[model samples]
Target: MKKTLRNTILGLTVTALFISGTLCGCGKKAPPIPASRLDFLEIEVAEQEKYIQEAEAKYLEERAKLEAANDSKGVRLLDTMNRERLRNEKQILKKQQKELEKLRQSEANKK
Candidate 1:
């Protein structure tokens, strides 16, 4: 009976020491996730960049076509329309560029 009681006390002491050792290690460390990974905004910025590029390309092409055409009523009408279209495309490009900047700023703020 005395041997059994001594064995039980030893077992309990070892178990308590193991549990204390495990819990002691947990309090001193930081969390797993870093600050940068919590908020990601690159994908939206990339999409906005793509949209701005395409809009700029289209605006430049229409401006060139407007410049090359001979002056006539139809040509004048087309030129007017192309000019309007180019203006709209530029506005869209500007808007997309702004969105990209905003996304980048938001991402930077997260870090």
Candidate 2:
């Protein structure tokens, strides 16, 4: 009975340590991104910028058409959808930019 209790306590302690280490990330850092990956990220950012510009132009054109037709509802709906889409796209772009910056910084540190 005493041995069984000691074993149970040891097991609980080990389990707690494992859980804590996993939750705390084990003090590990991410692997560095290569220069090729950075170049790809730059290209991706450029493409995203171009896509955003095109989307804005298209939204304006559509808005103009709806206004000319005097369709207030269509205009409102289009505006809402465009706003949401732009918001999501911009968020993605911002996240990518941050990642790129982080990788670049890490690369610079290595140099």
Candidate 3:
């Protein structure tokens, strides 16, 4: 009987102390920080800076690929135009040669 009574009193005392400590806010909760004490802008700036850097990198890579494709297209166009020009020049030269030959034949007939 004495052992059980002593255990009961000890349990009650522990319960009372727990209740008092909880009401006193004796647990480890940090105090609320004032807005001026927080570095919210700094944290946001860092994240935005990271996002901007990634965006720039992506833009540069895409622009490089686009420019390379455009350069290839330009080269192919120039080649096609140059081939057309050469063909026209060849045709004009042949016509001029034929006219010269006709004049020579006429001069021989007159002699």
lDDT of 1 by residue, 1-111 (tens): 999999999999867765656434655442233244222334444655676578667756756675677435655676677668767766765766676677677778979
Q: Write the per-residue lDDT of candidate 3 for residues 44-92, one digit (tens) a residue.
A: 4455556556655665565567577887675566556655855665555
**TM-score (all chains, Cα) for each model:** 0.39, 0.67, 0.34
The segments of candidate 3 whose C-alpha lies over 4 angstroms from its true place after superposition are: 1-71
For candidate 1, the TM-score is: 0.39
lDDT of 2: 0.88
Clashes of 3: 0
Q: What ranking emerges by TM-score with the best candidate at the front?
A: 2, 1, 3
Show the colliding residue pairs in model 1.
none
Model 3: lDDT equals 0.59
Q: Give the best candidate by lDDT.
A: 2
| Of candidates 3 and 1, the better by TM-score | 1
